[model samples]
Target: MWKKKTKQFMSAGSETKQTLHENLAFTAVEQYKLIRANLDFTLPADEKCPVIGITSAMRGEGKSTTAVNLSYVFAEKGSRVLLIDGDLRRPSIAKKLDIDNTHGLTDLLRGKGARIEDFQSKRRDNWYVLPSGAIPPNPSELLGSDRMANVLRQLREMFDYIIIDLPPLNLVSDAISVSPLISGMIVVIREDHTEKKELEKCLRQLQMANVRVLGCVMNGVKTGSASKYARYKYYGNSSRGTGK
Candidate 1:
């Protein structure tokens, strides 16, 4: 499922290093707000926390950064949010957030039988983080396993929103494997970095997996004066009926 009437929101000069910082681009705050509002349409009508998986057609498109900042926006709005670094292959949230990656998704998937709270590191008052524990030999298999499904089930019950940072769809099976388990997907695309054919192939992969694409986030839009920072844009149908 996709739609034609796409809604778009953009920002200029948003740095990839720490868009979470207060001194970020002038349009940074507004950008996050619009992006959050865009995702609001995908929330369940009955209050079940929406699990939004963020991924890209290829790497370095800023998907992980988007996921982290999106979670921060939700948390800032008083929502209890959990940001999971689901990109086990090349995890980055731990480093980005400066949170411990000691124990996380992989540990739980391996039947650690631990409390969700124990593995998660609370970065902010409302934002809890679950870094990709340890790189495993079989990322795709671990992500698609029944244990992973159960982990997400538990996550849904424990937070207002769970934002999973998945790997690029075209480069790895990790994103596609876990796409079925999420409420919806947000595709991140860099202005000139991502290839057109790759984006098409990624969309087809999502289509074949039967995952609802909540929207597409366009990153690194060049602005004359605003080029000092990195910014993002989300294109989707904001008027679409809520949830998948």
Candidate 2:
């Protein structure tokens, strides 16, 4: 049943990547549902509106895609999900979602008396997006500021799930600075692009910061077919999977 649903959701190649649109394939939806389930199982039961950070070992590993899709699936399941473009260094949620990027995280954290509602943009009935706003010169400092924490706290009261798309772990320290505030972090790795050594170093950095490693999403797994259903596999903390 699940397989059939997934096949219905996903059609072929690039089309399967349209998880943000209304015509998202069932395959993409199913994959995100699997990720959401894994996240639910990984987080503490007491944590509410849990802020989950989606990151990768390096750039182009599909962290933003994972974050957006995960938030879409959660909102589809009736949970109010807020997708935050925490990757201030290179924001893409606005462009990918085709929404307004006039204001967002940086604006809210700038301490200019900006409110959360002022920067937030709704993508769906229950799904919202907060773009990275204007790229700041000091992304690390802004992300680590007390204002950022306050923004998150305020968001938790209004959202059931706050999915943050952060910069790659190996590229910068921005993710590490924001790690302590999130409930857990999901590492996305491309099967062909991410090297084993790089993935190890990424995990080590997260470990040193005491970031809760929820699990990993193995992305870009080729099945020797031109199918649009990209293979995605999840592994929990106790049984982390090895990257290519």
Candidate 3:
């Protein structure tokens, strides 16, 4: 099991990157690498351009951080990865990654007359980000719209992996709306924060929706929190099946 990563809740912009670099424990990095390996093993081999969604049962469970770091790890091998700010209601990727949100996923989903690439800003070599754009009046409607499908279709041809940072499942259905679009979803659960009931309910929701849930990632773990240490060790050994 990984130890509690200090300051896991990162600051905005460049500070986010700095905090991540400063605070990410060796165990945490290895855990994420293992997560990538597990996903690579579990995801259908035929799906070349996998679209993975990152979400949580409730807010502030480090879903965005997971998405960003996962994207970072995915791109480490020169794989083209695009991290999209799918949480249109309360966008975070732009602030977290310090990218522009002037026009992005929301814009493309609203039928904006422009190429999808026009809205995306490259964050690094082979890494790009499509921000949430202006906050939409009806995020669910836009996410479930035909334009969203079109945008994804276009994105598939461009990137090896598309990581979408979605809103909390318990808070809204925005995550559910995009469920059909993703190859699979990973639920982020924070230690000492996410309740067992909430996790059960989240699994029920995913089961009911028939979302191809990959599994849950345990976040904010404490090094010496006894059962939490044991629980995270369990997660490390059997990550993809632990939550369910």
Candidate 4:
């Protein structure tokens, strides 16, 4: 059996560059590359555009950070990647990436005659972002709407990988509503802060919804004398099934 590993979470402030892709350390970059490789191994060979959702059980578990870093790594591999801020209630991708959120996913879904290209903001040669524009009053309804599905379908035709930074599962039903549309989900869990009971509840919810969970990313684990030192490694090994 393959054992899971934990790595020291790279603090966003330590990097002089605003985004991880700009000035990420070798270890930190390798960690995300491992995640990307793991994700690729889990994806179906027939699937052209694998849409992955990154979420956590609660707030402050580094879901958005994982999503951003994973997207960056995928784009770095020369694949056309689209990172969408699916967390409409509390959007952060735009601010984190230093891009304008005036128009994006919500705007495109509203059917206000905005082109998809108009909403997409390119940060790199292969990476594009669709921010959660203008928070709506009914986020759940909007996420579950048919318009959202249509938008995803269109996006699938354009990008090789679509990464969605979703809201925490326990916080709201938004993540659940959009779960069915994604190819798979990656759960982000804080090392010491995330409760086991809460994590169980979140996993149960995903199971009840029949969502495919790729695996869990244990974040913010301290690297100290007491640590076991399970080094981050990416072998591109085939997965027997989802959920680790």
Clash number by candidate, in order: 7, 7, 0, 0
lDDT of each: 0.77, 0.77, 0.74, 0.76
Clashing pairs in 3: none
lDDT string, candidate 2, 92-123, tens digits: 87667655566777777876554655433434
Ten residues in sequence with the least summed lDDT for candidate 3: 1-10
lDDT sort, best first: 1, 2, 4, 3
Best by TM-score: 1
How would you order the candidates by TM-score, starting with the best? Answer: 1, 2, 4, 3
Of 1 and 3, the candidate ranking higher by lDDT = 1
Alpha-carbon TM-score of each model against the true structure: 0.86, 0.85, 0.83, 0.84
Q: Model 2: which ten-residue window has the lowest total lDDT? A: 1-10
Q: lDDT tens string, model 4, 1-244?
A: 0001111123223432333454555666777887887777778878989998888899988788778788988988999899899999999876666556777788889987766555433445577777798999998888888988998999899999999999999989998998878888888888878999999999999999998888888776554523232223332323555423
What is the clash tally of candidate 3? 0
Per-residue lDDT tens digits for candidate 1, residues 130-202, read 8798899999998888989998898888899999999999989998898778888999999889999999999
Q: What is the lDDT of candidate 1?
A: 0.77
Error at 49, model 2, angstroms = 1.1
Candidates 3 and 4 compared by TM-score, better number: 4
